[model samples]
Target: MLSPSLPRPLQPRANEVLPARLALSAAAAAEGIQLLTRDFAPWLAERGRANEFRVDRIPFADLDGWSFDEESGNLAHRSGRFFSVEGLHVTEEGQPYGDGPYADWHQPIIKQPEVGILGILVKEFDGVPHFLMQAKMEPGNPNLLQLSPTVQATRSNYTKVHRGADVKYIEYFVGPRRGRVIADVLQSEHGSWFYRKSNRNMVVEATGDVPLREDFCWLTLGQINELLHRDNLVNMDSRTVLSCLPHPDAGAGALLSDVQLRSWVTGERARHDVRVERVPLAGIPRWKHGESTIEHEDGRYFKVVAVSVRAGNREVTGWTQPLFEPVGLGVTAFLTREFEGVPHVLVHARVEGGFVDTIELGPTVQYTPDNYAHLGEQGRPLFLDTVLRARGDRVRYEAVHSEEGGRFLNAESRYLIVEADEADAPQDPPPGYAWVTPAQLTSLVQHGHYVNVQGRTLLACLNATAVKGA
Candidate 1:
């Protein structure tokens, strides 16, 4: 049940018409382009006085005594052994690792001990807020050197007390100069499978002159936004943190009046009912967990598979886990059109089985049909056909990025932007949907509602062309 103190759902204002065109000013447009073209990798490498980092995988045998248990449907480590399997336990009451006297409905959780910190250091230059980002390499990323957070460290690496190695610039976060907290939230991982969580998402403003580190570069919000238009250029963690940056709608070039938009959002929020119940991993219908794979009866959605990993930068040189593998590349997109010259993207209020919130705003289509052969006319993903059949010219931005490398072994999705004609756009979108301005969406992001990870990832891709041209 929703708490009583929570604000009432917003309702649409009657007969309020939105503006047709809401274009960005000339200054904003120039800023967007500047952000897109700024080169940071070469500069960072020169500063560090080193070659760009390289990442490689280690052999499976290097992981000491790690094995999968067919009987319990869990991964295990033998005594006196240490691997990345972290903590193994049930989620009934947040208990520690052990054989569980678990309830029938209890879900298994893999609590990775490394409490990895996904921290970004922010500094001001030329009176504009600039973020300190790293051109870091991940073993699983298609482009090895995508932009990463300034300080991506696990708990073991950051805390000297743990006898782990030291993390660079760790003082900015934990020390006396931890800067202002822009965003700090404990976002959950893929909850259906791994219960791994991290405390690393933070954006702090530096007060003093902070030394620049090798492989790290300073970027403005506009630059970051421009970089998001390219595929795999920005990592998932960076996208999530970037989504948390507060974007207050100045009402500049807004298509809809704030009142009307709020009403529409509130109406959509009231239109759908989402039901979620935790079930035992062993009892989910039409699913089977084998020693090698977790699959649906139809084998169309995703699978869980074991893999070996080795990384030079991670706390451990090697480890293994059952990672979620999508059978095919999925598509996540937003359908946009100029309404009276103002651009608005179609946003879906979607529900996922594992989401912390029952329903959050999502892209127009987020799907892979591997196990979902039945998702056609009457499916939850209502307009996927329209999006998939969209013309190539309608595509404004598209890029492929691998999912979380540390968790999922290999999973990727095509993030896209498709333009629709107002004539073809839904005159009245079905229940649980809304046409929201990018500014409104950004405001929703500030409140930390409406937008989901996939939605934010795609939103991060929205560029000056889409922002100004529309």
Candidate 2:
């Protein structure tokens, strides 16, 4: 439990202006920065020399005690503690915890004893808000130190009984004077993927001069947005939190009014409907669950496999969990064009089985070739071909980046940005799709609607200057 101490108000800094040249060069990360990236090591070393920061990776074998059951496909702690697998539970009747159509399916859930806290600290600088971010390393991440939240701690790390210390800055979140809660939502992890249902995500603003750690940095919303354009620069946790930032309607540059966009979205909701039927794991067509791996008959789409992880920063140094492995690179693309001088991305209303909301906003193209081919003939996603084959001057941004390394094993995708002519874009897009401006999308992101993870990731990749000019 956090100490119930009142936070002191933040004091103003003498010179809040950023240096003309950043110590960490974004150009050095042009080839995609990660833990293993050559340039990243030097940059980190420089920061380390100047500040007190350290990151070390530990192998699962070096962890205290852990075990895996090949027969039952269960991963457990040798001491019978923390998280463990309790086999598969089949729910024929809908349960209160899960109200989705996944009834009657064999769902594998990790019995975790503690819920984690994913909180972001915010402060005002020069009347502009800035979020305190960390360059933290996770065992599963491809890059060593992707941008992470100020305080990301599981129950074990934060509680005195577990790790014997409190998570830093957690008092700002759980204790009194938690500042104005900008975004407080219980966002679920991958439902079809992770056993952990929802992690508490919160964004709070404090008005006081807080002590700075060597690994932490304060970034304006604009600067953070600029960093989003780079591949694998921002971690999934940060992107999800950024997706929840509030956007006022007064500064929008779109020709369409908020009422008009809302009306269009409402009409789209009525136009398309999604139905997900839960089938038993054993009965799933062509899928075979073996002692070690789960795969489809065609050897495509995705496979589930267990992996042991060790991280010095985490509460527990060692643990095992099943990760999702894709057959090939997935593609997520957005087609943007000027909408009365404001850039509007072609958004799709997509339905994922794991999502609480049946339909959420996604990019114009979000699919793998194998999944796209499996969508039958007519069920294929719209504008996928156009985006895939997009070439010449229309291609604005294209990069191959790894997925969330924590949950996904060796999963990556091609994130694309394409420019289209308004005249060429469809006036009457197919049901469940809309052309929403960057401002409108930002507003929707605040409400946790109109944009899904894939969409938000792509939105983060938008060039601020390019969008402003468009």
Residue range 1-470, candidate 2, lDDT tens digits: 54556533322341222211111222223232222244444554555355332333333343345555555545566655556643343433322221222344344334554557778887755444567877766645655457788877766567644444456788778767676566676655543454434566778777567777666677755556556666666777787776665433343776567898878767655554433443334434456667666677778767766665644544454455555577777888988877566667888766454455555677888777765465475545567667866776788887666665665666667888888764546755665667887668877766654566677767656633343233
Alpha-carbon deviation at 403 in model 1, angstroms: 2.2
Instruction: Give a tens-digit lDDT track for model 1, residues 268-353.
Output: 54544434343335545566656466666677666655666544544444445445556788788888877666778888766444
lDDT of 2: 0.60
How many clashes in each candidate?
A: 17, 10
The residue ranges of model 1 lying beyond 4 angstroms of the native Cα positions read: 1-72, 76-117, 125-129, 153-163, 184-200, 220-223, 252-280, 373-380, 463-470
